[model samples]
Target: MHFDRKNYSDKILIDLYEALLRPRMIEEKMLILLRQGKISKWFSGIGQEAISIGCTYPLQDDEYILPMHRNLGVFTTRKIPYSRLFAQFQGKLSGFSNGRDRSFHFGTNDYHIVGMISHLGPQLAVADGIALANMLKKEKKATLVFTGDGGASEGDFHEALNVAAVWDLPVIFVVENNGYGLSTPSNEQFKFKSFVDKGPGYGIDAVKIDGNNVLEVYDTIRQLAENVRKNPRPVLVEAMTFRMRGHEEASGTKYVPTELMEKWAKKDPLQNYEAYLLKEKVLDEATIKKIRKAIQNDIERGLEKAYAEEMPKASTATEIADMYAPFEQKVVQPQSEGKNKKRYVDAISDGLKQSLEKYPELVIMGQDIAEYGGVFKITEGFVETFGKERIRNTPLCESAIIGIGLGMSIKKQKSVVEMQFADFVTCGFNQIVNNLAKSHYRWGQNADVVVRMPTGAGVAAGPFHSQSNEAWFFHTPGLKIVYPSNPADAKGLLCAAIEDPNPVIYFEHKFLYRSLTDDIHDDYYTTEIGKAKLVAAGENLSIITYGMGVHWAREVMESMPELSADILDLRSLLPWDKEAVAETVKKTSRVLVLHEDCMTGGIGGEISAWISEHCFEHLDAPVMREASLDTAVPFSPPLEQNFLPKGRLQQKIKDLVEF
Candidate 1:
């Protein structure tokens, strides 16, 4: 086996041969465990050995790798310890996610591996963020991302590619064109033969290669990786391979024909590469046998050690996980001390401005965010102060931008992602609910992303542009939903959201942007989350509301000067001020919950339900909820006003008080 070291000699050939064989053996071990009921599932890279090994081996240890489920070779090539790898499969405490993720859906900061979620395309944007971090650090390190041909059809794939190419990021996207995506073949999934011709559309270099040929894949990817580091641009390499097995071991290959299966089996990467090494005299029969024996022994010992490790105790699962944590408030007095009369828009801007000054690495990204300062002028002059790098104007891809923010949040910078309009958040909803909201719970990953959503009707922006979507994320755990009432709270809460370790969906009322103005604090202070502000304290009735509803409740209370009533502005939605609501309900003996979002399934229902359960004895009347009628916001101004309960809050409050 011994040979020259300077070139691609016998020793290097044997090393490649061994690396290729290790993942195969590990999958075999996992399959046996699956049969024995020790493991649940197996996603084996049975036939795509060359594509994984060649593309991975060239990258430096510092460069991050965002791998998919079938990338067993990636873990082995990156030197992820076999003991921990087996422990993960067995759902033990010794694993990366401490049994939270029993599959290959686990990643670690230590290894710089951003593992996949079940949905394929989201990790592409995450990889983009990793490369963006590298670029920001002025490092030449490249980010390698792996996805299947089917995942290429995903929005995340397109969004990630566009950002990488547009920003000129150092990223090598290796699309393992393994003919089949789950059970669907490429013929039905894609219109193009391969993604090679598609890279130019996104301003990236493209290459197509024989995925089974280890040497060819290695040489091509190595050269591309070097060029990416030097010039810093996105490159797409489509490696054509075949899935010799089903999507998983449990999924039998009944859909695949026997002839097609036989054809790919003959062109097996490991088998072909092993023959190549033998022909090149990299190893003789004895040496090959010894290598195989050694690998088996090493795997057995690691597997034994992994099996002996303890499982995560049910009582202590969330010990290390950060979820639903309370906000820690800190007041910082301004050194110069200059207060300013500010509109709601100005307060949000100043809050962001103060946060930017506080944390220089805070990145603000969205459409029209750079020069235009957002469509509503919330971030005007932020680009000039923070520079273009910090204030990023992203393309109209909602999902990827949030995906990019998540990547940055995990890897380096604290980020605030604006949706342009709250309604458009549906485009990026998966990234928010699945990735951002679940990352902390799944793997103890910190999602320091603040999504600024401008919401509410009454601006005549119509359905697509105007809508309150707070209820969409109310059901998602690991998210902090803060909808502020006024300028002071808006600024203070934006700062607080940016500082929080978890994900915050900050809903700023579009109606309040210019309509609400007051003298705001010049210094930095975070308004406490999960706490209510007592706007007008009274004894007759209680109005519990947030966003534009808070002001409406106040207006309704003011209209009736003789009837004193308590108005509690719920600043946060997900962690709503339950204590304040209960106390006010007990004192006033009645409650009126309101919001701009539609009536059915709105957050108003959640509040009403909570109050009914907790304050049933204290209440003098059932909780009356006043939300917009269950319908899309109309374009007609008269219809829109009628659709929203802006003019009806007075009557709703009266009904609760009279009851």
Candidate 2:
């Protein structure tokens, strides 16, 4: 409710002061490196050092942290080697991210600086997840999540706050109110005067502090962190600080007024804290000078070491790329193997049933997934089979639905989350893109979660209900995207996705749920992720498609026996089988790409490009693409049919055979 200063021993005060100053020098060196062309451009924390150091001081060595790009002070306090920091800026081998991530996107699990996401607000969800995991593990630690006032505007921020509040997860969300997001000020970004005010709405304890005062920040975070560890509830601390530099090294302050800049510079957080130390007799003038000199020397040494270090070997790049290497072997069909046969939904039911039986830690949470057995009845009889504790029905908040899943996933539990519909997924986009995709890449910890959504435009569910947005996830790294058209593949892929070591987005075709059925084995089976399935073989043309589009192509192929059309279903999008696709194209001289997404910037574009580049000589004609019209999927039957890629398979086959 109110800010209070904590009394500390003289030695502790001096150590805090030194910690606060170390990052200031490092920030300066980074800017200099950028100017000298030794490193790429970066955003400097500058005057916000006090907040970064202050929040970090209270965190225990084993506690987790999720920082934004501007928290250079936090990185220094966590003891991330300054050389690795510089190497990251230089985009070299010694970089913490191995040159995969840009400057400011560094993370280290060993230091408990769990993760850092550059795109902003999504880190909040990750912080919530880490906190939830800690609680489940019974670890006496809290997670500190840092973001700017600008990031607070994202929907994921609200979702994370609410979920953390509901679960009473041990998390402290530190909002670095640095007055500007790029050039836009906080006042222009939100209707609320302070971000702390948004916390109470989510049932989180909220407070605001004078972020320029290092001691005030230190005291606030220390108490909040301790409270979180004890009570294990979410708290929001809005630190009102100032950004004394341009948004990034590439940005100029030409748009910033001279008078305002000068005014803020006079109250620079680092200088103000130094004055406070002197006034309180906590740090003498000589000690302050010595500390500054020591920090400067350390930074210089780090820079020299970083400059001398070799770039990450090209092999390291291949290794990083190999992390998601596809499982190449063919899936052994359950029915063919003489196992008991089951439907696609039955396989999902059985897999989850087995998961519930095998792993007591696993829990199922989503809207209407418990008693109602989900809107699609995919979870039919699950609540009865697994009981309410394992099968939970959450509130009608899509963001909250995903946020809870994220939290549960972090706890090392197999959390199966379902979005009622795929089109409504925009409500939880921030969670999927920012939190899920970056969790392992940013934190070096596996989320091991599965998100199942019924997708595709059919049954005239209308614009809102019928839409395929899998392309959105396909473009995002660190997330596995699986779209299974047949019941057998759906069940098998869903099982594999659940067991994956990473977060998986499982897209189930709504049109195929009951309308189409295949003979599947009763025993559990899993299709390899990132590997495509060749449904029908032909030599003339390869019709590469996924989800409902695959079914359409199959229908067209069966109708036109004279047209030799080979069909390949790419079940997984990211880490997709480029090798298999290239090989297939080499055999078939013509290729046609199809999907349910809008034609512009659809998944087809990427696939077409890949084929054209890798198997160019194998093509008999320019790759043909058929996708839904560049418009919202219509609700009317005729319009919906007209909007989709109807009869494109026949035309593609005709062109390929004739060519």
Candidate 3:
């Protein structure tokens, strides 16, 4: 706590003290609000303010911090207006996320800080991406990311650290060892002698610091920040501190030992810092009280405004559709260079290639994506063309790979991440649904990412390789799901997905990759999203499908030419154009919705329900749904065929038509 007066300016010392006080006061007011029932819940950082405050010193204009829930003091140090902060926590319209999210789950792009969600593990990779972006842009700026001991143990933590080190990214990862991971003690969290030891293993330089000592923490961060900016290497700094309270107010340390609580109370960062300042004659008692009073007054002022601010309307939660609104913005009416006959796989590759030509900042990454061109050879020659920086070959870590795209998209890289197989998406489901899908709604920023999911079966790739997993993403909000059935739609939709300003789940049918072929436009153009294609027109009935289902429906129609029906290819499901669906359903009174996924929870159910609700008067028969059985996609060719909707689709349509 002692510092030479000549070495450390009195102003710096006072600023650090104020930084600690601001968050403390905010947290105290939050506790009061929670008790009053004005705020629903709060994750109190309480005694751990020093780490959030201390490490934020000497922040440059271009620099940004990715903070955990506990790091409210980082806001104080970054000069985030108390008005927005208060409004955000209060779920008011003025909140950073427009009250779309609560607590530390909001962030502001203008403020240069991306807030963390409850699953904060993924943000490490995200921070690495932001830093990678700045490095790619040659910006002399760094991103500082904070995490707790619990988050440090997540898979993303190691993945991000290794990637950061390998890339020599300018990221300073600080782990706040606050004694507990929401009730679990430090001894139970890690067996390691020091968490800092992880740095050297990952090829990152690291250090452990006194988190409670504001001056020491600040000086360490300040010095390391210099090394990060100048040398551009990922650095790990573990800050030893204590929560000194339960995870949140509700927990109340009922399970925590009283003696352990007492032990940390004696080392309270606030009291110790005040005592140090007083002992060093750096701050008089009157001056200290005045500073504390000022911070309290500011908190009161902000809280009053927040209380007066209007809460978001009931409709705030609904209409959470594709972020790319008023679709005219992404219209690409580029000149076409005749037609080129291509397979579905090559068409998608062409789309990616053309997307890169248009979006200079576009990058694609996945397992064996670079040199090997992926297992399907869809990304073949992409690495050689885009180079390793743009076309990255990632390790076999789905969570980290998807997390990298989640971060890259936020950094404006317009990333396209391919899952080796759609079934493997389970590996990174947390990042996909929680990180990529929730980014726009939670942060009010553009997280334009295209996750190319090669879904569906025909390849007999078994349960772990082939899956009609569109149902999973269809249920999640804030994602644009595009499933193209042919080469033309695949090319155009993939192109549009890349340019669209939102997180898009592009499902490319692995079965149709090499099997399907068509002469597609060899020009830079974008297919309209949310709009379905009328593959064939008929007035007797309507057969709505997407992906491999389109082909199945087409084949059925060829045999049953008498049962004439309009085949509607719903290119995308998340933002399925309601108007288009209703028109088709109304025109052809009997409607059959089909999909390759299980019948129980398939997207066919949603479409069937919607048609029954919206086009009820126009219906000649109850909306029919034809889909695979509620079972895993079997490996055996016979079981797989029976598991698919294709075989039963014809009979189901006949039954519906007769009915």
Candidate 4:
């Protein structure tokens, strides 16, 4: 390969050498620490430093980069302090995640980098979001994202590429074909000729290059980045390399054939690059030796500083306090002078309309949500009112859209994603539970993304379409869940969820979309999350519920006026109003927790246990729970009615009140 002197000055060439050398030294030293048990684990980028260094060298500081675990050169080339990087490895308080996460699992906003979670494919969609933000702002910025050969096979990889191409997003997808994915070889991973061939299927242009040659890697990435920046379209680059070490220090490379290692050893990126630089008279042996010595000394000092740092404090209360950002629970008062009767679906539309007016950067994304106005028509005429930029339609790619929303949130751009149905959230479950739910805690990045879930069973949409799935996200930390029963609360809670800085799961009951109506206020308002609404206050017993259960409880109470029972509508499941629950339980002397989800593993079980533990002394009877039967939602309407607890709720409440 000929060195392109026109593109690289001697100074730039030497800098690239140092950039490649730094991570090599860091990994060499870290492996020793791993053996000594000072560090927990190690994922070495020993032979593949050129790929990370080369790909990152041409990027502007403002252009975002999302790197996988093996891309240590991305951190080193960005000039992250050796001390902080060492502290992160040692799990000290001085690290980026403040010891909340370990190894390359953490990301740093200061460097315009988003690190990968264990699930590697979601980051590709996240990169699409960052690229989307750049395009929306009309800035000349691009996003560089990395994935392995195995990672390319993931659904997110294909979904992200297809969407990026469809939107013409400025993203450079780099696939490092490192021969092995953990222990599995490339033969079993894919049947295609190469990742480059897979790109054309997604309507993307792709090329292949020698990843071991730093110059080739740098030139290829630089040219692609410039073209993408000017034209704003995604391109793929496949870098051929080999992983000389195991996936981690513990996972030995026994599955790899011995001859393969011997072949790759001769083609080491650092050695070959150094030999070329020497042959080109870029630098002599003395200069190379001096650079190595300096890097070693720097590593020593960094390790020493990391060793002196203290571990995170041993306090559960402190850990809990830092789990979520502080949100001001605003009190909203209803207007008494308006004739504003509205359906639940209309109220949601009003809330979204109001939110778009308030937040300039707010975007709403879902399948057929643009001119077609979504399956429920909640966004009817929204594209004309808000423009196509804000009210956008998405492909049936749930995981990619959620990851894109998260990526937009990373750049301080708020987004709202409506799952066509609550049950469909299972398709995007990994991105939700692993990425959105953990981003805030793992790093200081708030996922200001609201996921609107059309939930509950009643319309005979089948088991796949009809489900009350709030309990799925209710159990996860770093998420706020709000389920509203009527139009007023629906609109108010929707606004609140949009305004919240953390990730929020906003559950809209599909059945209540048209079935329930209220005189909702015409003006913008916000219902406080973690607050319960007191409906039909009484002294005999308390019916604690949310979503469709609120309507069922209200119906049962209306039919049986003789039983003086109060209904507590828990609007928020995660930060459920413990104060309201206690007050209501103490006042009524008996409580029944109800929900539309299946009986086992429902949110009602947690509420019932909480009441038993805290309000045991004030209770006149045992904490009772009324929920749907523990079985898949029946598609048949008659069977569905039997499966639901609504049919027997009146009798169960009567028994509890009598007992």
Candidate 5:
């Protein structure tokens, strides 16, 4: 598998040798450290050094690469200081994620690298997002992303390829078919002949190469990447290689056959490549020895310095502050009030329109959200005004689209993603909870993306479409949840959510979209995110609610004046107004938490627990909760009406007041 020596310069040949040698040497040192308990784990990439070094060497500084756990060459080749990377491996304060993430789990924007999460598939789609940014900016940049033979089996892999092909995005997917996933053989992982064979089904160009051959990997990837950057389409390169050691240092390779291991050992990437370099007279034995000695010295110094660095402190205040990016909730009241009445849906449209006009970096993505508008028609006439590039319609792949938006955010592009229905978000739940929610805290990366959720019940849209699902994301940290009750609040809260430098879940009640109307300002204005609005103030008892529950409480107050109480609407759920809740609780000495979600695991439980713990002395009665029945929303109108908390709100308020 020797390549022609005449095709490459001496510098390129020498540079490739250095790249391949560094990771193998580093991994060897790290394994010794792991045995001494200096580091907790190591995934050795001894035999497959050629794939990472070759794939990474061809890319420019501005182009991005997303690498997996075993791709140690990505970090070393990118010229990240060896000391800081060792500190990251040791969980020291000086690491890239400041000790928040470890090993190859962390990413640095400075190196134009995105690191993989333990769930490997999401990063594939995330690469699409990076390429998407390049396409929108009209930049001739290609995104290279890596995944194992095991990871290629994930749904996100297919979705990512389809998305890149459909949009004609420049993304080079490098599948390192290392013949095993952990202890599972590649034969058990997929039925296809090779990953390259499946590329045509996605309309992507494909190639298979000897991953153990450094020359072939470098030349093939370099040439293919050039074409992709020029033409802007996804291409798959299957690099056939094998792991020379266990998946992790701790996971022994007993499951692998002895003959197969021996067979792969003969084709060792670094060993064979180094032999060819010496044979071709690229470097003398003295120079080779000098290079090895230099690499070993660097590794020793890096580990020693990293060990001396201080460990990260577990300060409560600092930890809490680091959970979300700093955001100031400010309510900008209109200078001159003018009555421009509109339905809840219309107000959301206005807010999005204004956001689009205000921020040129803003892009909206969803299924049928472009020329067809959204299923709910929230983005009607938007594509005509904003154009398809900004008002993008995405595939039915929810996970890929969400991950794509996160990728775009990484490139400083603000994105607004509309979940076709609140229930449909389950498909993208891992991306939201695992990737998006953990992005900021994992690194200093701000996921400045708004996820528009059309939520709530009472429309008889059945179990799948009509459930009140705000509670799902409310429990997850590093996310902002905003649920508005009326048109003005809807418009204002949406504006605030879009501008906030955090991942915001903006829930628009499907039932209230056309049912409610109010006077919204013609000009843009923002309602404070964490501030609660007092719809009706009274002292008998307090009814704390949000979204449709606000209207339900208002109805109870109007119908039964005897149940006079302070009705506080908590517009934002994550950083909900604790001060206002305390004030109302202390004022009335009684509280009733209400929501449209099912009674058992709903937000009402968390609210009541907090009230019980913090405002214990102020309570004249136990904190009461009124929520929908703990069952799926029914299709029958009668059962649906009975399932909602609105039917029993008056009685719940009466009991709280009487107590």
Candidate 6:
């Protein structure tokens, strides 16, 4: 089709006008709602509406969109019902999130809109995965991700762009350079004059567009999206725009200079487009007035519907909470029966290999898992065995790795993501806490993903490399945490995790990786999650431990044979076996909890409190806990040993045995 600049009936121009106005009306209504206190908060796309709406013209219904908080424009232009969006603001049952998520956090699986992460930059990685999945599935869809210029400074943004470039995924990263990120302006936050400058380093095509010009954004994005779909390569589109309003309802224009604000207001995309439409005779003054009035009426009707919509009942939260609801249980037989019984690492390799054999959709990705077999060689020869298509190597982007895993999981593929070490998980905290952990709960969807991190301390690797931070995730809701203390349990739990429907954070203690010798069956086996195991039977005291602490406690038990101690290993922390712990405490009438993590807010504390509340009458002495000190793990062997819970078991044995 030849470009027709003078024709008002030109298909591209008409489409652009429709897209821009749709979001503009939504933004105007949102502002009114905010002022009336009908909506608690809102982030406006007042001036940058053209970029979001126009740039997305080429996207099909099957294509994925991972937008940021300021994407009301994109959603509105994409035909998401304004009533549903307003219901979200009111926390109603009819909202996209069913009242589980805040107003800005919206997602619709039917539309292939995965949802927005309130945190910045992480969605870039998520978009990469969606694009990668499209390529793998042989789908014609492309993935478009949007973020502000300020978000480009985040580590995840860089990580995701790099990976997408290397893999040549069908991704279009749109940077809405809307002058400011909250109160911080782009000039102050970024060192580069334009975000597109960094795209060359990642080997991706990059372009900067006049965000205020709807035609320019529409043309550029359409061409880029076409090229990306054909070649399945990544591209970066930097849309230079301006924010016409404060960041959110809570923000004020106190910090913004008056002259600068006036300049941007004069360059408003909506006003510019309105003039263009009038000058081109596409719409006369009467027609323009009619369109404005119609949009106003639509907004009013949407607001009325939203206000009348019922809020999600309290029972709804309780019902959804029932999914992760705790259950009471006594010691049950460990559920491990499989085709291959081998060491823990062997079990992992076999399970993954078997999964690949059974389901071609399974993919294993991490830093060194491809050819290096992982840091611990648990995935040794996976790349050569499974081929690069299934076993892929990722950059040193922890957040991107996990984020991609989440996206792939959402696409119905079993993705196993590994962190080089558990200590480095902090880099991916946003992906875990904000995106993966809460995705299911907030969006009423499931992310069948598995994240494995090698954890615990004993190798004198120091603070940065040697630390157990499971407590951080134990407190996080909607995440299933599993720690295996031995080879059998590790293999069994890993198998279970891969098959589960929810997100699982599987922590493999490095100290226990090859530390024990056990005869495992050669068949596939999976242990039950949310259950604890009774390793030994005793009468004096109950010792509750997990991971490497289980081994240390056992040694103490053997050393002090005079003290008959019962040992319980809690493999799962979030939905821990409270009933098992209570029963054991009640039976032994004394308890001692041990863990490798820091003492404060450790799993031991939660266990101790549960026992104290439920089995207080059965106790012979106060519940004692043995855990690492609050300080960081030391490099010196002596200091590290002293910082750990090595002597707690012996002391507990003597004290409890005497009692």
Q: TM-scores for all candidates?
A: 0.96, 0.85, 0.95, 0.98, 0.98, 0.94
TM-score of 5: 0.98
Model 4, range 1-659, lDDT digits (tens) per residue? 45565668999899999999999989988898899998998988889998999999999987899998789999989989889999999888888887888888877889999999988999999999999988888898889999999888899998999999999999999999998899989989988778899888888899998888888899888888889999999999999999999998789889999999999999898888888899989989999999999988988888889889888776788677666766676665654556499999999999999999989999999999999999999999999998998888998899999999989987889999999998899989999899998887788788889999998888887789888888889899989999998899999999999999889999998888888888989988889989999987887899999988888998888898787778999998988999999999999899999899998999988989988998899999988889999988999999999989999898889888878
Single out the weakest 10-residue window by summed lDDT for candidate 5: 330-339
Candidate 2's TM-score: 0.85
Candidate 6 runs further than 4 Å off: 1-12, 316-341
Model 1 — TM-score against the truth? 0.96
* Per-residue lDDT of model 5, residues 244-351, tens digit only: 889998898888899999999999988888889888899889999999999989998888888889898889887778778887767667666776989999999999
Can you tell me which runs of candidate 5 are displaced by over 4 Å? 333-336
For each of the candidates, the C-alpha root-mean-square deviation to the true structure, in angstroms, is 2.4, 4.1, 2.1, 1.3, 1.1, 3.1
- Candidate 5 — which pairs collide? none
CA lDDT, every prediction?
0.85, 0.77, 0.83, 0.90, 0.90, 0.79
Task: Write one digit per residue (lDDT tens) for candidate 1, span 85-127.
Answer: 8888888888887677768787887877888998999999988
Give the worst 10-residue stretch by lDDT in candidate 4: 330-339
Model 2: per-residue lDDT, tens digit, 538-565?
8778889898888888888888877666
Candidate 2 runs further than 4 Å off: 1-7, 249-281, 313-341, 356-365, 381-415, 430-447, 475-479, 534-544, 553-568, 573-630, 646-659
In terms of TM-score, which candidate is stronger, 1 or 5?
5
Model 3 poorest 10 in a row by lDDT? 317-326
